[model samples]
Target: MKIIIISYQKILFQGNIISIIAPGYCGYFQILKNHAPLISILKNGFLKLELESEKKKIKIKGGFLQVKKNMVIIIL
Candidate 1:
């Protein structure tokens, strides 16, 4: 799936990811390829991204996320 993470300053990340773990308002949730569409409010925590054989993480204060049609967009 394709993912993009942006903040007020700049785009933090934009690329293809195998999976993602986001800090939801209630807890953490994971997104995988072909997963159902989702819209969620994020909390202050870490965002994990898996790309191929590599894994990456980013810290977020808070944000909103949308997932649709294999595309994920996160605004922080």
Candidate 2:
């Protein structure tokens, strides 16, 4: 799936990822390709993504996430 991570300052990441794990308000959750639609509040923690070649972890202050139709958008 394609995912984009953006903030007021800039776009942190924009690419196709195999999976993603993020810190949700309640806990942690993972999103993979073809997964169901999701929307959630995020907490201060890390956003982990599995790309084709590597895994990346990005620190987030706090934000929210939206997933739909194989696309994920994270605003921090």
Candidate 3:
């Protein structure tokens, strides 16, 4: 899946991933390839991205996320 993360400052990240774990408002949630369309309010925590060779994590104070057609857009 593809993901783009943008903030007021600039685009934080844009990449392909095997999976992602996001800090949801209620708790934390994981989105893998072929996830259903969704929109959620995020919380102060980290977004963990599992890439081809390694894993990465991005810290977010808060944001909104949308997933559709295997694409993820995150706005902060």
Candidate 4:
């Protein structure tokens, strides 16, 4: 799946990934390819992604997450 992370300053990340771990309002959630669609609030935490053999992590100030059409759009 593809993941995009955006912040008010700029677009933080855009790439293909196997999974993502982010802080949700209720708790932390992991998103994987072909995961069910969802829209949830985010909390301050790290946004972790798996790209092939690489694992990337970025800090997010908390925002929102939307999953659809095999895409994960994170606003933080």
**Which residue runs does candidate 1 get wrong by more than 4 Å?**
none
Q: Could you give candidate 1's per-residue lDDT for residues 1-76 as a string of tens digits?
A: 9999999999999999999999999999999989898999999999999999899989999999999999999999
Q: What's the TM-score of every candidate structure?
A: 0.96, 0.97, 0.97, 0.93
> Candidate 4, residues 6-63: lDDT per residue as tens digits?
8888988998899988899888889888888899999888888888999988887889
- Candidate 4 accuracy as TM-score: 0.93
Which runs in model 4 stand beyond 4 Å of their true positions?
none
Root-mean-square deviation of every model: 0.6, 0.5, 0.5, 0.9
Whole-model Cα lDDT of every candidate shown, in order: 0.96, 0.96, 0.96, 0.88
Tens-place lDDT per residue, model 3, 21-73, is 99999999999989999999999999999999999989999999999999999
Clashes of 1: 0
Query: What value does the lDDT take at residue 48 in candidate 3?
Result: 96
Model 2 lDDT-worst window of ten: 30-39
Q: What is the lDDT of residue 17 in candidate 4?
A: 92
**Per-residue alpha-carbon lDDT of model 2 for 1-76, expressed as tens digits?**
9999999999999999999999999899999989898899999999999999999999999998999999999999
> Which is better, 2 or 4, measured by TM-score?
2
